[model samples]
Target: MTALMTAELAWYATGRFYRANDGSLADYGYFLHLPFADAPLFDGKPSETSAHFTFAATPFKADGIDNGALSLGLDPVGQFSLYLQRRPGATFADPASFAQGECIATFRRTSLVVGTTVAASLTSASGAILGTNVFSARLIASNPFEFAGKLYDLAQTVGMGITQFGTAATTPVAPPPPGYDLVLPFTGSAIALGRAG
Candidate 1:
């Protein structure tokens, strides 16, 4: 009878922010994640598929305020994925396919703004001639904020494209059936803003 076993893996990241201009004000803060997983074969083996996380300070920029006071914010975004492919044998210098890895998840953020202004003036000459003038102005701003994060696990599976096995045996193959369970987690954050001066 074939034997079966299970494994687990995990990862995490963190960061801090200080005011680049003024020590009293916090300019930005952030955190990011690298890929990780849990499985028997995954021990020390290089990961085929991996993920990254990112985070940053909010309210990147602001303008058009009577007072110079500025407000800040934060946001996060990232991606995650898993790997499926066979591990190269000890003697196999270049195995057809190492670990087939891919990203299956993603995230993002968005924001926008618009504005307008108008003015008019008139003047009279000594004779009877009159002169008039009118002026108008419009301003628009569109700023987008984005953040993302991701987590992933590694596994053994078949190759793709030219590396695909013959039709009869083309089906993807997962070594150790149950495979390894890895948890590589990551996080990211950021903020952006636009305004008319």
Candidate 2:
């Protein structure tokens, strides 16, 4: 998908659960919003505002983990990086889940590298550093397709890592968070769209 290098790709990821480093579990839910960019009227045709795709979270899924956005970048020479953000929402259905907070994940391909992908930090809305995570991602597919003049890929991915209750940045509190030291195994699929026409 070299075409993705010059364009911004919009993607969505979802998994069944968030397993902590210590072997606990929390519910996982996801949402997908389509129409990455504005499609304007052309050739005297009407704008298609009603054509869209959305996936609402199921009742069994935790609330705060509802919406997620993903950005994947792959360079010409075969390097890749990804950024994922999940917005916080209502109370958690699974008490094992982390406290309501805005979570961000940043990871890079490590196949040719020496170490694990960079660690990601989770922070509360209050700006307090919650915890940190270290994980590695594997791209399951690279086949690309075109839709409405845009390039698209239905990519599958898998990850394994640990989420510890404290950050390596500074002194962690006396007692770690609820899901501290939990093992995390992830399986996700994303609908990626390239912006370049």
TM-score per candidate: 0.18, 0.24
Clashes of each: 32, 7
Give me the overall lDDT of model 2.
0.27
- The clash tally of candidate 1 reads 32
26 in model 1: Cα distance from truth in Å?
9.0
Best by TM-score: 2
- Please, what are the lDDT tens digits per residue for candidate 1 over residues 1-197? 11111111112222222222221211111112222222222323333222122222232222221112221122122111222222312211112122122222221222221111112101101121211111111112111212222222111110010000000011111231122111111122211111112
| Candidate 2 residue-wise lDDT, 80-107, digit = tens | 2221122223222332232223222222
Lowest summed-lDDT stretch of 10 residues in model 1?
Answer: 158-167
Top candidate when judged by lDDT against the true structure: 2
